[model samples]
Each structure stands twice: as C-alpha cells, then as structure tokens.
Target: MAWALLLLGGLFEVGFTTCLRFVDGFRNVPWTIGFLVSVTLSMGLLEVASRSIPMGTAYAVWGGIGALGTVLVGIWWFGEPGTPVRILLILALVACIAGLKLTAGH
Candidate 1:
C-alpha cells in the first residue's frame, strides 16, 4: 500500500515536473494551475505514504520514479535527446531503484 502510494505520488511528481516545462514561468495560467495542483497532490501523497513506509526508502523510490518519468517524458514528448548512453544510465537508475525496494524491509 505504501509503495503503491509512493508510485502514485511519484507519478504526480512527474506530472508536476512536465507541467513545469509548459508553465512559461508561471505565466501560462492553465499550465501553472496544473503544476500547482500536481505538486500539491504529489507532496500530499508522499506525506501520507511516509506514515507506514521507511522515510529513506519512500523518498528514494519517489525521487527515482519522478526522475525516470521525467526523463522518459522529456525524450518522448519534448524531443529531448535520447542517446544510447543516456538510455543506459536511465536503466541503471531503474536497477538501483529496484535494489532499494528489494532491500527495504517494508
């Protein structure tokens, strides 16, 4: 359950980050609102998940998911470069995130 919440929260983190890309420094009203809402929901879910999950594990996983999601979205949706090395590093990060989850007692 906590991991599930962490996943959801991390997804929201991705949402907020992607929205940030489109916000135009908070000047674009709709995107700004999306950013604000996503950030709020992400943080709220993180806090809730922390209650049952170890803080370090939860945080690391959340951040990893957010980073992974952001990178994928950037490459797929924003025309960011997706070089071989970059993709390999992203996969390594996924492995590390999985390691953390497997070792975490939660």
Candidate 2:
C-alpha cells in the first residue's frame, strides 16, 4: 500500500511538472491551479508513504519516478528530442531505481 501510494505521488509529481509546463510561468490561471493541486497532492502522498518506507528510499524512488515519467512525456507529448545519450541515461536511471528497490529489503 505504501509503495503504491509512493508511486501515485511520483505520478502526481509528473502531473505537476506537466501542468507547470503549460502554465507559461504560471500566468495561465487554470494550469496554475492544476500545478498547485498536483504539487499538494504529491507531497501529501509522499508524507503518508514515508511513515512506513525508509525516508531515503522513498524519496529516491519518488523523485526517480517523477523524473523518468516527465522526460518520457516530454518526448512523447511535447516533441522533445530523445537523443541517443538522453535515452541511455534515462535507462541508466531506471536501472538505478530498480537497484534501489531490490536492495530495500533486509
């Protein structure tokens, strides 16, 4: 349950970023509202999950998910360039996140 909440929080992080991107430096009222809501929800979920998950692992996983999802969305939705090196680095980040999860247990 905690991990699931953490993942949701991370996706909200991506939501926040994506909303922010559409806000034009927060000048757009609706997108700004979306960004604020997403930020609040993401932090709230992270706080809830941190109660059970180790703080370091939870934070790393949350941030990693947000970063990975945001980059992919940028490439797919916004036509951001997905250069070879960028793709490789994103894969490396995925490996690192997986490693963190695998090592989380005693």
Candidate 3:
C-alpha cells in the first residue's frame, strides 16, 4: 500500500511538472490550478507513504520516478531530443531505481 501510494505521489510529481510547462509563468489560470492541486496531492501522498517506507529510500524512489516520467513526457509530448545516449542513461536510471526498490525490503 505504501509503495503504491509512493508511486502515485511520484506520478503526481510528473503531473505537476507537466502542468508547470502550461502554466506560462503563472499567467494561465487553469494550468496554475492544476499545478497547485497536483503539487498538493504529490506532497500529501509522499508524506503518508514515508510513514511506512524508509525516508531515504522513499525519497529516492519518488524522485527517480518523477524524473523518469518527466523525461519521457518531454520526449513524447514536448518533442525533446531522444538521442541514444539519453535513452541509455534513462535505462540506467531505471535500473538504479529498480535496484533501490529490490533492496528496500518493503
């Protein structure tokens, strides 16, 4: 349950970041509201999940998920470069994130 919540929180992190791009320096009201809502939910879920998962492990996993998801979003939605090296590094990050989860003992 905690892991699930953590994952959700991480996804919300991605949501907030994606919304930020649409926020247009806080001038866009709808996207700004989305950002606020997402950030609130993300932090709330993280706080709840941290109660069961080790703080360090939880934070790293959360951050890793957010970073990975954001990068994919950038490539797919924002037309960011998807170079071979970038993909390789992303795969490496995925491996590291999985390693952390495997060793978390949760």
For residues 1-106, what per-residue lDDT tens digits would candidate 1 score against the true structure? Answer: 8888989999999999999988997999999999999999999999999998888888999999999999999999989999999999999999999998899884
The digit string of per-residue lDDT tens for model 2 on 50-75 reads 89888899899999999999999999
lDDT of 3 by residue, 1-106 (tens): 9999999999999999999999999999999999999999999999999998999999999999999999999999999999999999999999998998899885
Q: Which number leads on TM-score?
A: 3
lDDT of 1 at 87: 100
Clashes of each: 0, 0, 0
Q: Give the RMSD in angstroms, all C-alphas superposed, for model 1.
A: 0.8
Minimal lDDT window, size 10, model 2: 97-106
Q: Which residue pairs show collisions in model 1?
A: none
Q: 46 in model 2: Cα distance from truth in Å?
A: 0.7
Question: By summed lDDT, which 10 consecutive residues of candidate 3 come out lowest?
Answer: 97-106
lDDT of 1 at 27: 100
Which model, 1 or 2, shows the larger TM-score? Answer: 1
User: By descending TM-score, how would the candidates be arranged?
Assistant: 3, 1, 2
Candidate 1 local accuracy as lDDT? 0.94
